[model samples]
Target: MRTQVAIIGSGPSGLLLGQLLTDAGIDNVILERATQDYVLGRIRAGVLEEGMAGMLDEAGAGARMRREGLPHDGFDLTFSARHHRIDLFGLTGKHVIVYGQTEVTRDLMDRRAQTGGVTVYEAANVQPRDFDGAQPYVTYEQDGIEHRLYCDFIAGCDGYHGPSRKAVEGRGLETFERVYPFGWLGIVADVPPVSHELIYSNHPRGFALCSMRSNTRSRYYVQCALDEKVEEWPDERFWDEIRRRLPTETAEKMTTGPSIEKSIAPLRSFVAEPMRFGRLFLVGDAAHIVPPTGAKGLNLAASDVRYLFDGVREHYAEKSDAGIDVYSQRALRRVWKAERFSWWMTNTMHCFPEQGAFGQRIQEAELDYLAGSVAASTSLAENYVGLPY
Candidate 1:
């Protein structure tokens, strides 16, 4: 088979890129190692940066999002039982939308189907071959048969564990990573949210977050030991632990119910330099990852897609390689900034195993200053709402 672009992954990054390129009259095919049902079944972050929300609209997949997603202007940060509001809109004139990544994937998948775009699901042994040369292609096995797909370019959107990043092995790509000692025990329930906006808390026990998917659906998380097992934490224990970490008033008024879904996610910050390798370009988790503290993972992916789409569009429309030539340099600049923010937020709110009493005092002082200083709050707001693409 032949196409203009071969995308290795059907996640949001690859799907979104395919949608944009197809809409622009570019031919592309997406390959996925998992079934569509399996892909959508995976739970992910819900907060959408302003820039990402806008990108969804551009791709014609924002109708359901715009109709159902909540617009949050600010969020609460609590320490020492005191709640401080960070005015996202008031400080930066921009706000984020509470739309689940799962919904985004669904919308993109539906759009692709409606447009008759090609996406091969359950592809096995998917690999990118000769991406460094002008004639790049992808190969995979399907239905017990091996198939080769030739394309003008390859997009590695398959994520960290996927083959796209591994294809560049021995190619001199520098990687940076830091894994936190703890994980987040998260649950999604049908209860109404504890608050209208998200609340991030630094309690004496650990760190907790109260977020929502809608007015009637709540998502909450509390820090846990890295090796904590889900079976060890039943619904009752999860609710109790989260409530104890919240402020007295909020906890008293909070609604508790049986959890619909539960899991523990480890926190980590990872990045691979030079997102582009010859005719292949890495997007989203394929190139970088961020701890979820600042809600930067999906947003960073959207930003990478934006840069890559522009480059690909310029190459086809104007017959110029100028945009594609610098894809890595531009994407990495923003990726590093987001990395710094996620790292800082994780450090500020979580209790570090290595940080002694002195570190606690320093964290308290930083939070105190953040609550009192307009400059500090604005800086947080700007990054929270997202920097310009």
Candidate 2:
């Protein structure tokens, strides 16, 4: 098989990249190691940043989102029992859509399947070989048979652990990494959201977020110790912790049943240099990972694909590889910004006594300042709702 571009991983980044390329009259193939159902069912990031709704809508995948997606102009910042709302649209004229990556993936998949312009190879392994030369091949298996796919270029949207980055090992790529002392235990429930807007709570106990997916489905997150076991913090214990962090009036009537999904994700930050190695390029989580506090994971992926498509277009249209050439630097600017925001939000909201008495005081001061100053509150709200694109 041969294509102009071969995208690894069918996650949002890869799938959106393929769609962009297809829209531009470029042929591409997508390879994923997971079954289609698994990819579509995976529970992941749910917040779409300000400009993301517009970007995806223009890309021909926003019809369903426009029809049924939830929108919020701002979110609530809760400390103790007090709630302060920061109007994101009022402050920055931008607002986020409360939607899940799963739905985005499903919509893209449905459109791609119907158009028949994008070829998705599920349960396939893409091994990029001879990238330094003109033709690169991704070898994989299908229906118990081995096959080789040839493409002019490869997009390593496969994510942090996929083969794309491994293929670029020893290529002098600069890397940065940071792992926090805590992680988030997330849950998706079939309950109506307790608040009309999302609530980000900072309590002596830990950090908690109350966001919803739909009128009937809600999403929530709570900070947990790094080594906390899923078995130890069962549903009952989970709700107990949630109640402690939520606002008074909301918590009194809040109800949760068995979760449709639950999991713990380590809070960490990582970024790779250049976002490209010869004909292979990385986009989204493959190039960067942000702590979810800022709600940037999915938006960053979409932004990276925009850059990747522009680079590919430059290569074909202008006969210049400059766009692809600076892909990493361009994406990293926003990546690091979100990284800083995520780190700041995490450190500010969560109690970090382990860092020392000074650390605890600093966190408290941040909370106080955010609550006291309208300017500071607006800054935090704008970033939380999302910065520009």
Candidate 3:
């Protein structure tokens, strides 16, 4: 097999990249270790930055999102038992859309299929080879038959644990990571959200986020011990706990229902420097991960794709390597800023049992200042809407 680019994942990042490339008349193929159902089965938070939404529009996949996604001009931040609204659009002149990540991937997948792009699902042991030199290729197995895909370049969009990053180990690749002591215990239920907009609640109990996938379907989360289990959190207990964290009035309005999905995710900040490795480039989760506190996970991946797609386009259209040359530099500058924001938000909103009372008081002071100061609130609003590409 031969292609211009070989992508090693079928997740949102990989699918988005593949769609952009196909639209640009660049031939690309995707290789996935899992089936299509498995890729779409993974539910994720969907807070779309304007830039990311525009990319979907560019790829001809934004119709569904624009039709069904919820647009928000602002979100509420609750601390000290009071609610302060951060007017995202008022401060930054930009707003975000609440669309599930699964839906975005589905749209991209549908677009890819419509365009007749190739994706090899259930590919076994996919390996990227000879990326350090010109003319890189990939090898994988399917149905007991081995095959090789020759491509001009390789995109390591396979995510954190995928073979692309593993392939570059010990070759001057550096990684930085911070694993949080707690995780987010989240549940998805078909209940009307208490508020039209998201609420970030900071209580003595912990941090709780009241978010929704749509007007009728809600997704909620609360901070929990890293070792907490999903099975241990029955619907009734989970509902009671979240209610305790929210404001009294807001809690009274919240509707409760059985969760269709429940899971716990450890919060962490991780980055792999120098996203480029010769003919190979790491994209999205392959390069970095931010705690979901700031809702930057999928949006960050889109930003990475934006940089990489531009670089790749320049390489082909103008025969210039300039964009590709600085791909790592450009992506990391944005990545670090996002990491800082997520880290700061996480530290501010979450209760650190380790920090005791002093820390709690300090956090309350920070939240108080954020609510009272226009400059501080503007900063929060700006970051929440997303920093410019």
Candidate 4:
């Protein structure tokens, strides 16, 4: 019925926050609307920025990642039939790990099960009640029964549509958002990746990415009309687009299997200001979201959890609320920086279908600037490598 902290949504943020609190000898409960299987099985982002990997490693949850995850020190940027590899480690002394979100969730859940440090209430509908009051509770329906979980504070780790965001809608929070005209059609194919390193291609056809989820399983994405449907893209059509963007000379032959999964995710950047409402704090997608271009969704969520854990630990450890008081403002500074980086990367690499010749020329000029100037290239590499946590 009561605890030191109650977390809504069992996504990365909530789960990681719970784990951190548990490690600090704090009691917390996590509520999720989806089944445990769904949360652990769903495919999501795979790129882990350098700092993110270090954080997970320090948290003692990087075992599986160390075994199966691919480590990349650089990625190729292709434009005008030229390939320029940004040496991530050489330029910034950083590296990224290619591990799917599914794997990260599984690792955390496994740790929770073994240590008994977290109470995961899955397959439940969670509603935030009395966030402004000293005593707040999360009411949820589980197995046809309603349960009210009261706690000292609530951490909203839920995604965009979760109940936590709407719970404080009347508090006059500032919202900033931008929706793109295109979406990415992403898929996981049962084949080896065409390239050893991730490739970001700028072609006349459109924007395409070549990445690997694992040694045998590969992930790929292509820009399409925002309203495009799955039914409109057949197997042949998908391969055709990949070939056009990758070009035969540089890309290996893709052996098509049954398209395992497909999704059309609209490109957008979103932020909700003042991520705190009384004792209910918002982190991760519940607070802000960046498009997949910069691969910041899961990493940002992890970073937010780190911040929240530090703040909450200080609050309880030292009998001081100073850390918790400034949590939102501190988190927002990093959030806005990521937002800008993601938006800039998306626009710079992806060409609009309706872009005129002048627009094309401008993009070319930008790429040229990045490629020609060591200063500009280093800046790109630093931002792409990631900022300190």
The lDDT-based order of candidates, best leading, equals 3, 1, 4, 2
Candidate 4 C-alpha lDDT tens digits along 1-389: 77889998887677778877887888998888877888877899879987677766666778889898998988988887777888888888888889998888888887777768656556466888888998888898877988888998999998998888888886978899998889999888888888788988887778899888887888889999887898899877887787788756766566666678888889899999899898999999998989898888888887788788888999899998888898898889989989999998898888876687777778778887888888887887788777886
Q: Where does candidate 4 clash, by residue pair?
A: none
The CA lDDT at 126 in model 1 is 95
Error of 4 at 320 (Å): 1.2
Q: Comparing candidate 1 with candidate 2, which one achieves the higher TM-score?
A: 1
The lowest-lDDT stretch of 10 consecutive residues in candidate 2 is 117-126
Positional deviation of residue 297's Cα in model 1 after best superposition, in angstroms:
0.6
Global CA lDDT computed for model 4: 0.84
**Candidate lDDT (C-alpha), each:** 0.94, 0.83, 0.95, 0.84
* TM-score on alpha carbons, each prediction: 0.99, 0.95, 0.99, 0.96
Model 1 lDDT, full chain set = 0.94
Q: Write the per-residue lDDT of candidate 2 for residues 1-389, one digit (tens) a residue.
A: 78999888998888788887887888898889988888987888778875677767766899999888888888888875778777888877778888888999988887777767655556466688888788887888878788888999988988889888888878887789988888899898998888878888887788899888898898988998888887787788888899998777878978788888888888888988868777888888888888888888898888888787999988888899898888878888878888899888888777664856677667767777777887997877777766664
**Candidate 1 residue-wise lDDT at 29:** 98
Q: Across residues 175-240, which tens digit of lDDT does each residue of candidate 1 receive?
A: 999999999999999999999999999876899999998899999999999989999999999989
Steric overlap count per candidate = 0, 0, 0, 0
Judge candidate 3 at residue 167 and give its lDDT.
Answer: 97
Better of 2 and 4 by TM-score: 4
